[model samples]
Target: MAKQTAKTTKRSLAVINTIQKLGGATLDELTGELEIARSTIHLHLQTLLEEGYLTKEGAVYHIGLRFLNHGEYARSRKKAYTLAKQTVTELSDRIDEEVEFVVENDNRGILVHESFHPDSHFPSKERHISTAPSSAGIYYYLHSVATGKAILAELPDERVEAVLDDRGLPRQTAHTITDQDDFIRELEQIRDRGVAFADEEYVDGLREVGRRVTGPDGSVLGAIAIIGPKYRFTDERYTTELPEILIEYVDDLETEISDSYLDDYR
Candidate 1:
């Protein structure tokens, strides 16, 4: 009975995750994608709908907005997220560039906050900002982006190896480092310099500089990054100017987080 219950729970959660990834799914689509019997999929879907975890329109079922409440509550529990939002916003406005705060979860980087400069403009082809209401909640492979790499640099080598074992080094662009040894070397450089740079590694023509933030307890919190077009991120700015500014902002953010929370709290 215990084993059966566990299996059922896993299937139900899989149903929810599949619907989320598809944006919405019909009964047939869910059954086909999950390779479960139609009757089993229908049972799972109906249970989720009754529990208000899903909403149906016509033949399609979608992830319920109720998840928003849970997501927001989870985000609110993170003091760094709240503080980073304000810090990134101010930093973006000051630099007239885009800024992002991202945290590691399940070995993936989750964007917690993103801010865009008021006067910032990108060529249509180079626009990397999402059209969604907010770019928060998006996930990225830790090996792909500057902020993710910065956070990875702060993690222990064993943990980093475990993450790589799970996610592997999938190539995101021509410049992305797919070799594990090369990525490990890159992380060493980031640790030495206290910053990470993504030169069209995750997205074409976009460049970013990132620094990790730590709590008062010296635990890794997340990372902050400044982003812009390649033309704007010249060698001098990308390697020197922006990295220095990011380091300063992240240092200040770390101090504020430490001051605002008890040393034992985090």
Candidate 2:
């Protein structure tokens, strides 16, 4: 009985630490890392289960879904996403450009919403962005486009540094920024200004104009972007007057979303 109790206590500590630090740990990773007997680990997990601290799947353990339900509820109530749609779509039509909306999730910008060319095909610098589920979030590397850079510009340096350290920069195109120092400088420029651009940097014949969009709390909600071929984009709107134009549209989006929340309260 004494041996069982000590084993239980140690396993409990391991489970708690794993959940707290890594967010989730699969059984294989835990067992291999901890070098604990499966039966011993299972007993402590059963105790944590009874106490409502952790949950286990077939071979993995993670934070409970209860936390996720609450988080989703809060996200639904946020005015940021609710308010940005019309403006995003309108900006797409106004510029006849491919536009997208992103939010920071898991320390990377996720493109949650988008409005694109009639067929919805948008030319990305080195890679083409397809509206199909397979291509949307999973394709482009964060450093591969202006849209991604605009979102990255808003992150804390330490956090961005960690991401680069984790992924390193994979070369997609010759124009893609592969140098760490050069990329950091670009991020700095984006922070100082309110926008970032990919000037045929990630792909040949493609250009993008990107601007940061913010919520009332001033957190970067995401970015709204215009992307197209370098020839037409550089000649007409992008180099000419589109910066101010997109900025105005963003202002309209903020006001519109704020009104949405106000209407909901009323």
Candidate 3:
């Protein structure tokens, strides 16, 4: 009984995550994918349904909207995220490109907020750029994206090593830096330049420039990035112009966050 009780929580969470990944699943489908007993799966699904974490229609079980409440609550707890959203929106409008503010969590980067200009061209279907509000939950590998690498550059070498240990450098494109030594050198360059660039590293035809935002206490808050097509981000633009523009916005965002932090105590 103790063993069963101990395993119940982990198994139940796995069931929820699997259903979310599959969009929706039937009891038999979940049992097949999870390789758990049909009776046990049914028990877990029924409990989740009763707890308002899952909803069933006909024979299919889907993740419930209750998770949105938790997600919103988690986002609200980050004061910097609230300030960064405005910065992302403003930068997107100013540059007429897609802008995003992302934070590192558990060695992965999560999109806290994103904004797209009206003239922004959508990437091919193979890429995962989403203009919807739901895109806030999207996660990316730290070594593959400009914003993620910018955040990684701000972190200590030990913490960065830990992140690499937790999430290995997977090749997303031919340009991705998969070697540990090369990646470490790249971070060093980013630190020296105060900005990071991803030229077709995460996606085949996309390029991005990112700068890290830090709080008044010098802790890494997150990173903000501007993304566009490779053609638009030419040599001078990618290396100098866009980075200068991005750094300006990140500087303003850091100052705003610092001011807000001071205001809270006063």
Ranking by TM-score: 3, 1, 2
Query: Residue 108 lDDT in model 3?
Result: 98
Model 3, 1-266: lDDT tens digits are 44545678889999999998888999988988997888999999999999899999999999998998999888779788898999999999898988988999878999888887877665551247554534788889999999999999999989999999999999988999999999999999999999999989998888989999899999998899999888888889889998999988888888888888889999
Q: Give the least accurate 10-residue stretch of model 1, judged by summed lDDT.
A: 120-129
lDDT of 2 by residue, 143-221 (tens): 7677678878887889888878877787866788999999999999878767788887757777777787776667777
lDDT of each candidate versus the true structure: 0.88, 0.70, 0.89
The residue ranges of model 1 lying beyond 4 angstroms of the native Cα positions read: 1-5, 119-130, 263-266
- Model 1 scores a C-alpha lDDT of 0.88
TM-score of each: 0.92, 0.63, 0.93
Instruction: Give the clashing residue pairs of candidate 3, or none.
Output: none
What is the C-alpha local distance difference test score of candidate 2?
0.70
Candidate 3: which stretches are off by over 4 Å? 1-6, 125-133
RMSD of each: 3.0, 8.3, 2.9
TM value for model 3: 0.93
State candidate 1's TM-score.
0.92
The reply for model 2, stretches above 4 Å from the true place, is: 1-78, 119-127, 131-139, 260-266
